[model samples]
Target chain A: MTRMLTFLVVAAAAITIAACDTTGEQAMVPGAKYSMNVEDGRFHNIHATGQKLACETCHAGTEYQPDFVTLSKYADDGGASPGIVDRAACLGCHKAGGIATAWYGGRATR
Target chain B: MVKFIRMIDMERCIGCRACVAACYTENYHTSGAPWNAVIEHEIGTYPNTGLAYMPINCMHCEDPPCKKVCDDMGAHAISKNEFGVVLIDYEKCDGCKYCAAVCPYGVPQYNETMMELYPGKGRTPYENVSDTDRHPTHRKKPKVMEKCTFCWHKLEKAVADGKTDRIGRDPEYTPSCDVVCPVNARLFGDIEDPNSAVAKGIGAKKATQIKKEYGTRPQVYYALVGGDF
Candidate 1:
């Protein structure tokens, strides 16, 4: 009984650790991990129009690219999604008093 | 013993982006690597809301964290000159970006690809210059970290010509962004010289460097919105 309890406790701790790592990587997807889409319901839920945006809507643009140095900290690959460079795409809906959260000049604070 | 520094009066900034445009044009930076940026933040709340604009560049600290990290990684690409300007040698940069990870200000920008200024349209006249003809700072390469050099190219020319006295007073010797400020919000000169405009401004305005807790001892000072501490 002692052996079984110890094994179960160790297994639970391991699972918790793994779960935390995954959560840390996924929590700030819109800011850091834009390349990897989150299965969270908020990923495509455009606020005002209630439109479900396709990946291309935000990912298709070469005009502005992500600051690779900043992105690399979050994404191990050290690169943003193809054509999804800077926050230019999200600015359309993420400015002051915009449909989504306020993000300006690499800051998401208000 | 001349330590160059910049003093920005943020109280006078109108967020026109003229300084940003000037830096981009003067440096001829490719897409994604802006040497200067004007960060906007919504301050206060409700009816008391206000927008604060902070024009930031490389802090060019007395003890730069970027240089420390780069040197630790055995890159040794980052160097601080006698004039107190921090610069990166493009050739020596391995693009490992360890410096980027440590920088408190998020100053280093990694250029993955040298994209055209006007994408799909073509390179601008500024971008079309040959590497041989351009200043070393302007000779940008892909897959390397880049940041503002405090317009070291122009400052170097002043030193070469023995006209360091003309630095803050003349456009040829001044940082491009400082030279183009519509409002006289930007001042660049020798901070070590007690009589210099920047030094006097620092005293008169009680100018303070941002992120003081970092202990980097930045050369860039700002007359902040509320008050300089």
Candidate 2:
């Protein structure tokens, strides 16, 4: 009975922690604290409301390895994991006259 | 007026890393990143699966993306020589790795530290050579990008010796990787001359450049098992 009660308490705590770690809708902005890890991704929020950004937009068909940022390929689902993001891919949407803010060279242009 | 080109016949390649070892002996590479690598990939289905070895060095593209990216970032570190060999000026590079990030082939490796070839065994005699004695390409430093020069040091020597016509035939003029290939799988020569050995070999084998869609127009060509890819 003691062991069963202990197991139940630990399981309940884990569930509570995971629920608390969920990202809110407000964290989908440009400079938000987003996780690069696909497993813990809030990409759905970024892709919500007519965004419709595909996974291949930033990843796939690339072998570039950047030293600036760490890329994660973690995925819980048994799906095709996204490849590492090349800076060229980032420039596609992040450069001047693009969708996102023109941010590069250690600063953001508003 | 010579345009150098390197060719690899994949069908004849036995996956023997002799070319890779020859590169290390010729160039001082960091611990993790090598100037040359022989990658093995599978072709065909499970029933008809076969492996293919691709020995890759710097393609020395005619319009190198690494140079363009470096110039765009105001680095001005990379330069394509008259011979169409892409080289990085280590002094100008700040190790930002922007070139590394933009390269489709994953060339341009950054050396974090000057690790000895043998760990805890002290520097090898090759590594202990004075910097003055070493060629600029072989003088590797920490926190900078490095890649194959297509053995420009040898090519430069060939030019100085007035043996430009005998590059592919001369041992001192040819790239160490090509010279060391036991199976004669690798070839290096000027592709400008329609009568040159490399030009003839490429035409006869129907060799094609890989990743041509990137539009880098790499000078290196590969003779795959089948026809051009």
CAPRI grade, predicted model 2:
incorrect
- Model 2, C-alpha of B217: deviation from truth (Å): 0.2
Clash count per candidate = 4, 0
With candidate 2 superimposed using the best TM-score fit, by how many Å does residue B228's alpha carbon deviate from the native?
Answer: 7.4
TM-score of chain B of each: 0.97, 0.96
lDDT of 2 by residue, A1-110 (tens): 99999999999999877655443333333212432223444343344222555555566553344331234545233344443444556556544456753332222111
**Candidate 1 CAPRI assessment class:** incorrect
Task: List the per-model TM-score of the A chain.
Answer: 0.34, 0.37
**Top model number, DockQ:** 2
* Tens digits of lDDT, candidate 1, B1-229: 7889999988889999899999988887778988899988777779998887889999998767677656645678899887888999999987766566556677999898999877899777778889999999888999888999989999999999999999999999999999999998999999878899999998898889986655567899998885333
* Residues A6-101, model 1: lDDT tens digits: 999999999988776554432432212231122332334332113434445665632324443245445653234453224345556644456743
Among residues 3 or more apart in sequence or in different chains, the pairs in candidate 1 whose N, CA or C atoms overlap within 3 Å are A65-A85, A65-A86, A66-A85, A66-A86
